[model samples]
Target chain A: MAAISVELFAYPWDILEATPERFLDHCVALGVTRAHVTVSYHSGKFLLPRNRSVRVYFPEPGALYFQPDAAAWAGGLAQPVSRLAGSGWLERLARGAAERSIELSAWAVFFHNSALGAAYPDLAVQNAFGDVYPFALCPSHEAVRDHAAALCRSVAALGIFSGVDLETIGYLGYFHGHHHEVTAIPLGMAEKFLLSLCFCPACRAACGSAGVDAESLAAAVRGLLDRRMQSDDASGGQDEEAEHVATLLVACPALAALIRLRMETVTALVKRLSVEAGSAKLAAFTSSFVGSPSNIWMEGVSPTDVGELVECFHLLAYAPDVAQVNSELVFFLALTSDPARVNLTLNLGLPLTTSFSQAAAKVEYALRQGVRRFSFFNYGFLGEARLRWIGDLARIARGDSR
Target chain B: MTELRAGVIGHGYTGKLHASAWLANPHAALTAVADSDASRLAGLPAGVRGYSAYEQLLADDLDAVSICLPTHLHAEATLEALARGKHVLLEKPIADNLRDARRMLMAAKAKGLTFYVGMTHRFYPELREAKAQIDAGAIGEIVAANDCVLEHLGFLNVPQWYLEKKFAGGGAALTSGVHLVDRLRWFLGDDVRAVAGRAGNSYFGADVEDSGQMFLYFRSGLSAQITFAFMREEHPLVCDLQVIGTRGSLTVHTWQSYELWNNSGRQRKVFYTQEPHPAKVQAGIAGEVEEFRASIVEGRTPWPSAEESTRAVQAILAYYESAATGRLIEIGDLHAV
Candidate 1:
């Protein structure tokens, strides 16, 4: 059999304050041949005293801190905690992994500048509602992309991590605007919000090239809102009042093209960033039943559409390992049965109630169907109760006991 | 002065529910019930009458009627009631499509009758409290919100009318999802300007969508994500709302409990659950009945005019447009279409 390697991915949140010695012991005990360490650092808020040659605004409440001055918002980068913790822990883990011959990857939440948004208002995503979102940075913005690249480079240079994993970029829905937070505005306000997007010259030019009539789209949304209000009003604004709201139907082909364009932009950015970090190998963990064909969220796309989306991702060269499938058992079976051509390792992470025997059965079944690798989400989250199966997993990985 | 008599058409599930609410209230008399199924209309309380045909039931001295027919016959039955000058309480969605909805609205308007659509979740106590708080600006400028409804197989039992495109305009989105859309629009205190949606029939192989997700943009620059699906087993029917603002945040869980978090003080306040106000339900029916009665009595129009219903139908059409086309469809564009 091919060498069974057990790789453990560690989240940054779990080891923010952990000592290197503690991590090494844990890794050794868990039989983790390779560990992925995450380093995340953020400052909470900044106070800008007027006439001090700088202006600052604290958009979010916690996690980001910075001094309000020219030195802070401009090129004022804080030290990454992963750099501090990994320096010592990575050495020990590296020595342990060398002796045990394990690999390591560094995990990072990519394109997320929640800290920057909180500390520096200038870097925040501004919504049409005049509210600044502190937890999200616009992927379309150049400054935001640069900041993300710098962070990626810093993590890559750590030398201890074999790879880097980036998370949560441009996944926020269409109405998210510049704010990371979701909002409830009247339906009548839709047109005003649509005008808020593509404000960046680059986005505008891109929309122009794509032949997207942003203004007309905004007006259509506005008209729909007005119609809804009028309907509700006609029903006397009563809950049980039945009122018919008019629907504005657009041609399907046009919509499909628009969605393709948007997807292309986002995927291109992802590929560019992955290649730039020298971590050409990428993995994307998507909920098993999201987007088109399996629109678990009811996002209006169909299962066939979702299959098309998966193909799109593949065309962009995203490996199957990058597409982490998530769903209940029945849905998982359905996804595996699709005719869509995919050639990546399918990682199945289900609830903890699944027994080792059952898991083995599943693994065996998947393996029979061309699955080459499998992994449990987290050994730590399993606890010590019935989670001793993790040891079995380690043995299986070592190919000595399983 | 004599108390007005009222009859309910189609005494099925929703019809029974309406009957119970009406019986508990003292505003109007439950005069009769009509159903094509004799077995369904077999039993009746002492003072109430039952009929197999709606025309025969309308011949009774009843002043108003609640048309709780299946989706396919909503327009026909409602029009019949309005033509007879009887007030109406029609169950949602108002009709199967924009054309039917408009026809119903126009007919009701031409006859100067009372027409009301049943969207009962608005009567939930927690939602009422949240609306009050929002109107008071306790949450400041509203920013975003999310609404989720999950079920394992809620659509399996949909009647044949729902399966026929000639009856149920769309699928789960038009049926169950419409509730969330209406509630979100109500809570946001604005209209839904544009919508981008994705829907599919994953669990069930029906042509209609069993699951859907909608991203709504409001006129006030507020954004929301509304998710509806038939894919959960044990989770309670949760119609929850989370509204963020400049000053505080207000969340209503399960549509009956309220929680408010003040941004400035960093304090969270939980509100007690209140009983569903009977007066509100009665008031809706009462207003609808009074409009019809007044139109007949004094020759005037109703407050919740047919023009309003036309707008709502247009909005529903817009949702279908966005869902079918996969584009952010504008609501007003439907007017010309």
Candidate 2:
């Protein structure tokens, strides 16, 4: 097994509230040499049980934690900032990390901004039925692409981060974990893929440019989704998801070309953003709340296409045991040839890793598969005991006695 | 005058209540009961007829029928009974969706047959008393209200259809919280202008949600918040509501007790403990059934009209729409859909 290095994922508010010294001390105790702090994020109501301050935190919508290059994003579709940036909390944390010889990286979310989308409705992802999903910016829009690139460039300009973990860089679907999601109608994989397909003006234009019939495809998708919703039968089981998607693509061959166009659009954006983050490493999450890596296509993410551009792929193996983690790694490895460029990001707390042994086992299995780096999800959201499990995982990875 | 003959289409929990109410109402006689399950139809009263299919029961002699089938079947059953020239008392939530609800209402209107919704909670004595007081300005001008129901309708407690989304339309919100929404609408005598809601199936992880929360904004400057769940296994069923007005506040709990507080330093409380006598508990449904008969006998509209029930359904659907969109949904937009 390769030597293991674990990085802690945290938020800037958590550092300021816990104080840099205390936060870094906890990181060091867990053998964590690096930390990924959220630089740009979307709106959410979080539960921080271990925090010294408020138990619940509602962050500013689409907030940029660090100071952004004001001149860079002039006349942009999205304008969002966190009040904490004025307090210099991120810079203070960065300075603290520099003094302690701990590496800090910016965890930036790019397109999933409800505030920005709401402000510019035309820029958001519009479904085939012409309903705007204000939470997800349509990547086909050049302005949205520019906004994402500017976000990355601004984070890199801070000069306090080693890398930026780009989240939601591609297209988002109808179910992007908004405040109160009422999806009473259980959607099959094919139906969800159909819903996630963007029919925005830019997307349609892109499809037209790619020589694919966009109008008919959108109408077909709409008809299929409506019929499926109205049907009395429940959604098919997970095992039939792939078969269903295959059947759909076969029936609507135009959908295949459209999907490929979307993948190309995502790849082009990642390629552009990587160039913008000149000095900082460009890493992307392989999965989201949409599904596992197997269902990345729902987000217009093709790992094989993206793997060639980004420095690393953070395989979100947020599973309950080593077996699930193994399946995820197998699927991701098949897409990306170099396992060395892959890092395993696991939840260090309950519902995923219930015991120290389970955490150690996942790390060990990933190590055997040639994944050397592991990033433990969430510093403040995790309790003290889970933090200790991280230290044990690091020791086991390094073949240490402790 | 000859008594109105009534038959119950579904023999579920609410169906049984409708059956008992028909039998209890002197103006209405329980004629027949129909259920897909023969077991549910086995123990009917000596004089009452039993049919395996509701179509058979609707064909029999009856003045009105309480359509207590699953939410998805409410429109089909009601429309069929209406075609047979029988006055219909459809259950709460006129239908699962607006289109079907509108269809049922139109069918009844075209046929000139009396149609009413069984928003049974409106007839609960405590709620009725609270409504009377609110009407008499006991609570003054209403400002805000909150309703909560944490029931125990887990997988083992309910039939499979209750947990299925297609059949039940929704879980706790549509099935249980509909009553709360309708009652609040009735108390305020106002229409919900907009709604925002959140629902989850984290507990049972079934096709339907076991929990829901909603915020309703009325056009009359009134606001209400309703939270309900059917996930608690050990927790006893609790259904309560609190209405706050300019002069005072009124609270009703499970139709068992009520309390009123006025700004003038006067507080009045009424409590009915000791497992409310079965007759008293059944009185709400009996009153609902009686009202159904009275509407037909006098050729007047029912207490809770079909339009009122359709609006209640619209509010509930708006809750779902708000939850789905993660934004406040205007009730008018639901009508457009």
Encode model 2's per-residue lDDT on B1-337: one tens digit a residue.
Answer: 3689889999865687788788878777898999998756654677999999999998999899998888899888999999999999988777778999888888999999999998878777788888888888988988899999986653213456777989998888888888998998998888899999998998789887789899999998889999998864534456889999899999887645787888666555554422212334456778888888998999999988888878888898888888888999987843464
- Residue A231 Cα positional deviation in candidate 1, in Å, after optimal superposition: 80
Using lDDT as the measure, which candidate wins? 2
Residue B277 lDDT (model 2): 28
lDDT of all the models against the reference?
A: 0.52, 0.80
Clash number for candidate 1: 77
**Model 1, global lDDT:** 0.52
Lowest summed-lDDT stretch of 10 residues in model 1 chain B?
B271-280
The per-model DockQ list reads 0.00, 0.01
Native contacts conserved, per model: 0.00, 0.00
Candidate 2, which CAPRI tier? Answer: incorrect
lDDT (Cα, tens digit) per residue for candidate 2, span A16-126:
655454577678778888899898888888777554335568888987876677876553455667776765567556655776678888898888888898898898999
Residue A161 lDDT (model 1): 57
Task: State the local distance difference test value for candidate 2.
Answer: 0.80
lDDT of 1 at B170: 69
